[model samples]
Target: MNTQDAGPLLEIRRLTTRFQTQNGALNAADDVSLMVGKAETVGVVGESGCGKSVTSLSVLRLVPSPGKIEAGSILFDGEDLLSKTSRQMEGIRGKDISMIFQEPMTSLNPVYTVGKQVAEALLVHNPALGRKRARDQAIEMFGHVGISEPKSRFDTYPHQLSGGLRQRAMIAMALICRPKLLIADEPTTALDVTIEAQILRLMKKLQNETGTSILLISHNLSVIAETCDRVYVMYSGRIVEESDVFDLFDRTLHPYTSGLLASIPRKNSAIEPGKPLHSIPGGVPDMTRLPCGCKFAPRCEEVMEICCREEPTLADAGGGHCVRCWKFLGRKAVKV
Candidate 1:
């Protein structure tokens, strides 16, 4: 389904999350805006410290201590999440929206059995289900998420499970309540290739079955390409480009996006023997002391004097593709 034609399930506008560090206030997410259509899988891709995780945390109003959402709105199902009271948010989270955090080992409680944790999620939103029913449902979900011998595995502690099973348990916890939206932050991090592929496929299958919209955050472009319908390319603390998966790869406009694509190792393609893989020069700038103009200007190979002098707004460059770059400033929007 075309996201433009369908109403958005979640819409974030001008979100700015700030952290008060000893050095200065840092904008972890700056004017970040994106949308997830119903049942659509959207991806946020960028290197570490680029604010991808912070943006997701902001949406759930779970930004860590000393970090606050200074501005912007997060609209979910036409309701402003930012305006909701903590009590109201408690009602919304897990039932309406759930997140599978980056690391299962860290996110999952070591003290609790994986089954009990997943069951608790259901119990939180549906107390009437009772412990017996909740346990049954959690086990069913574990089976659905591909856990072998769900009944036995459900009783195991997070430390007892392998990384893949821990991840599956996390997914079961997030999906048990059948939330409308699932925010998966680096869900496959540290998994083997086979496990990663399995996890991605399991998510896709579950999403299809439940019709849940997913906002998948990852630095892996290959993962994004395999799963997401649309892509949002984040930089220092801002979205540098937004496009459908096909166009983002086929007609990459932003220099940073191009650099990222170039960095990916291509299989079955001719390559010079012993050639070094392409890498974007320079690390993400310190948020507190970002460059005066474009955050990426210092590393951008096609940087212009104007690029270094003025920050560019995210402007449409046709076919629903938006880019924040000096080069595409005056280009007329063209429908594909």
Candidate 2:
């Protein structure tokens, strides 16, 4: 498939998700906009609490209680999903688009057998299939995910499986129906490096075979670099920079993105003894009480006076790269 010629499979425009807090309504997702082209892989990279996972959940209209999609549109195949009814979304969710949630233990049912969960996903989307066929297909999926003795594992409960096996089962459940889009939230988290590589490779291979677009959410820049075509750097619930993966690594424009890239430990690179690993100073801003101006201004090394008084909008910085910093917005950064 020619990705260049294909239109976007999913487009999110000005999406804002909010949660009710004791203090007030906290904007978990603040006017976030992004797209995933057909047969393309887009990565949403950020530290914890940046709303990467919330953005994914909001796409599926599955935001947890106390939180709701307060504004904006989620366009899937050019249709607005925000306008869809819950019943309609039910048909959309595991059929047209599927999600592999962050954790398998919490996402998968403890009482049901692993095979049953996989079979249920298939059955929900393709309800005409018989139980026997669903069972057989579940076994097949388990095998495809590299689970040993698929037939035996099919009857085992979630607690009986190891973390890697459980995660594999979650992947199997997510992909069994071959949806057009896959929203994978931290798919390889908590796994060993070897298993993490295997899972990423499996997702890539499956995407190639099925021509499915992927929205990969991760905090690991290295994973995003390896698996994504385009990348969006999110900070404090807003996109700070977006570009092609190679361009993002080569010429990252946002200070937050630069800090994140600097923190990555380089392999085979000479390091001075007694020096500590690089870390971005400060912490993620509290969503309930975010700053009035640039949310990252407090911690940014290149912070300017205007950054503390004005919020910057994401603007194109040539060659499809967009940045939301004053330095890229035709304003010179002043020394603090």
Candidate 3:
């Protein structure tokens, strides 16, 4: 095992997952690869239904039974997670790699008290721990995640807490055992701005303190830019672009990445106030019936003849950047 001292904490290589739907087989994620180094944070950002959530779920082999990982591997600490059995994965989930879902209200057990729920997580991984010791550990972890009066909050039910507190509770539950890596899928979606900032800061601090790698998935481009060191932009089911945070925003190679950055609101823009937000100009093509060539070509502003004819491979484009587009191919001099 590579562990946290050296190399990547979690390495996902050419991971693909598809569902055999009634309509046809739907490709949720196709040949996606990325790395999360020890104590590093990598954000995966894309529009909804762009396979952001599915990629993270695939990391833990959590994708539904109907869907299958047809290719690639999830290498966690140099151990291929995809090769692990169900019982083996269960042991790893809370102990080595924990995940925090989007909605706390729905994700947290409604019937169990907050403390009891987190305590259960501790107990699950450590069968030797009795209920009282588990309860103490849960309270300590909850406090570590910034919950106020952890003792009192522990006994309260999930429904009794505010949305922000509930999210904190989720983080506490996920981090109770100090897992080596954490996957947060839009963890701040339901919280207000202040709470969002607090949670982000808290997670960052914990990452620094504990050296936990993070795989953060969100549609919020701004959050991705701020929190992540490297980013992977997904379109349709494939990774269309990957670059460092600054390169992504300053010198984006892919047209899809450019559009996403340009779509962010500006304080003093030249365009009229009523102008519509610049969407990609088309719905994401159905995965089951994706276009033959570059999946994003249908919505691309700089469409080319080759785009519809062949799927472009993710190729090195320069200075630590990779992009999949026919535009990168130098055109032959036209007979003018």
Q: Give per-model TM-scores.
A: 0.95, 0.94, 0.94
Best by TM-score: 1
lDDT of 3 by residue, 59-106 (tens): 888898798999999888889998899999989998899999889975
Cα lDDT tens digits, model 2, 253-330, are: 999999998888888767667987788999998888899778999999998888899999998878989999987774
Top candidate when judged by lDDT against the true structure: 1
Question: What value of lDDT does candidate 2 attain over all alpha carbons?
Answer: 0.90
lDDT ranking, best first: 1, 2, 3
Name the TM-score of candidate 2: 0.94
Q: Which model is ahead, 2 or 3, in terms of lDDT?
A: 2
Candidate 1: clashing residue pairs, number: 0
Tens-place lDDT digits, model 1, residues 1-336: 112434799999999999999999999999999999999999999999999999998989999999999999998987789998999999988888999876896668999999999999899899998999999999999989999899999889999989898999999988998898999999998899899999999999999998999999999898999999999999988999999999999999999999989888889667788999889998889889999888999999998888889899999878999999987783443322
lDDT of 1: 0.91
Q: Give Cα-based local distance difference scores for all models.
A: 0.91, 0.90, 0.87
